[model samples]
Target: MLLELRDISVNYGKISAIRNISIGVPEGQIVTIIGGNGAGKTTTLRAMSGMLPLQGGEIYFDGKRVDGMAPHKIVAHGIAHVPEGRRIFPDMTVEENLRTGAFLRKDKDKIEADLEDVFNRFPRLRERRRQRAQTMSGGEQQMLAIGRALMSDPRVLLMDEPSMGLAPVIVEEIAVIIEEINQRGLSVVLVEQNAVLALELANYAYVLETGNMALEGPASELHDNEHVRAAYLGL
Candidate 1:
């Protein structure tokens, strides 16, 4: 497994947000965590990326225990998290926002090359490279956030609620972009409330309920599961 969560738990102040949840993601595959509102999907991803300390259990990346690593250290280990909200620096130019993603890197030439590649992948970003992020549309900001994460050149991408609050057409665009990114050899662990889209995009799926893992299987199997069909797909 490229990444493994061994009975990981996380707490926020006095509240336990996650409870003994274990998950695994193989190299170069799209894995998804699907859940309803407040089901702890984002909390799970946060713990994996080291944004939240594990209250119990462990997280392993490439076989190294990473439970207590600093958030920046976690990024150095090849995991990049595009958080639920497009948390771009609203006051900065598009190029500057992307630059922040590569803050740990000193290879100026390589960074420039990667920036160019990012621009090529999202031409709209190139067109507005000098524009402030706050002025951009929501979908454009979302694209900027993902493109920024790509600037770090992560082996595994953790995306939280990428489809939230977008129009159907924009959601479709994001889906296509996700497939393109996965095709280019990056592994992804996607957390989404849109179970229909999440199941369709992932190779494997895990369902979380009330801060605990409820079910897990290959995406196709989960899609056809009676409980999943009834709860998530409403079918």
Candidate 2:
């Protein structure tokens, strides 16, 4: 596995957010976690990105332990997180926001190349390169957020609710970009409330319920399961 969480648990003060949550991301594949609100999907992504400290359990990525590492150090280890909201800098220009993603890297030339690549992938960003991120539409901002995460040249991407608050067309656009990113050899752990889209894009899926693993299987299998269809797909 490129990324593995072994029996992990997280807490907020004394309350448990997730308990014994275990999931794995194989190299170069898309793995998704799907559930309704408060299912611990975002919490799991935060833990994987080292933004939240784990109370119990371990995280391994690329053969090294990363549970207790600082968030910046986790980025240095080639895991980039596009957080739940499109958290681009409001006052910063689109280019500047993208540059921030590469703050840990010293390779100026490669950074430039990656910047151009991001621009190429997201031409709306290129068109609005000098515009402040706060001025863009929600879908555009989501694109910028994903583009910024890519600037880090990560081995894996942890994405939380990428489809949130977007039109269906925009959601499909983001989904295409995700598949393109995965095809380029970046592993992804996706947390999404849109179970239909999640299952469509992911190779494997894990269903979360009230901070626990409820079910898991290959995406195709889960898509056809009665419980999943009724609960999440609204069939």
Candidate 3:
């Protein structure tokens, strides 16, 4: 595995958010965690990105233990997170926001090249490169958020709710972009409430309920699971 969360648990004050949750991401694969709201899906992603401290267990990226590393250091170690709610800087221009993703890097030439690649991947970002992110539509901000994460040149991208609050058309567009990103050799960890879309994009899937992992399997198998269909897919 390129990234592994071994029996990881996270807590909020005294309450456990997730317990003994283990997940693995092999190189160049898309792994998704799907669940209803408040299922600890976001918490699991936060733990992987080092945004939340673990209550127990370890996180290994490329074979190095990194559970206690600072969030920026995690980015430097090749994990970039596009957090829930498309957390772009509202006051910053698109270009500035993208540059922030590479804050830890001294490789100016490579950063510029990665910036160009992001702009090419999402041409709308290039069009609004100088525009404040707050002034853009919800979908555009989401694009900026994703492009900003890609600007970090990470080996793994952690995406949380990329389809939230968008029209079906834009959601589909984001899905295609995710596929393209994965095809280009970046592993992905997707946390989504949209089980159908997630299962379609991921090679493997884990289902979370409350603070525990309920089920897991190959994406195709989970999609056809009776319980998953009844609860998540409304089948």
Model 3 vs. true fold: TM: 0.98
Off by over 4 Å in 1: none
Q: Estimate each model's TM-score.
A: 0.98, 0.99, 0.98
Worst 10 residues of 1 by lDDT: 46-55
lDDT by residue (tens digit), candidate 2, 2-111: 99999999999999999999999999999999999998999999999888999999999988999999998999999999998979999999999999999989999999
Model 3: per-residue lDDT, tens digit, 128-192? 99999999999999999999898888999999999999999999999999999999999999999
Q: What does candidate 3 score in Cα RMSD to the true structure?
A: 0.8
| lDDT at position 36, candidate 1 | 90
Positional deviation of 174 in candidate 3, in angstroms?
Answer: 0.2
Q: Which stretches in model 2 have alpha-carbon errors above 4 Å?
A: none
Q: Per-prediction RMSD in angstroms?
A: 0.9, 0.7, 0.8
For model 2, what is the error of residue 222's alpha carbon versus the real structure, in angstroms, after optimal superposition? 0.7
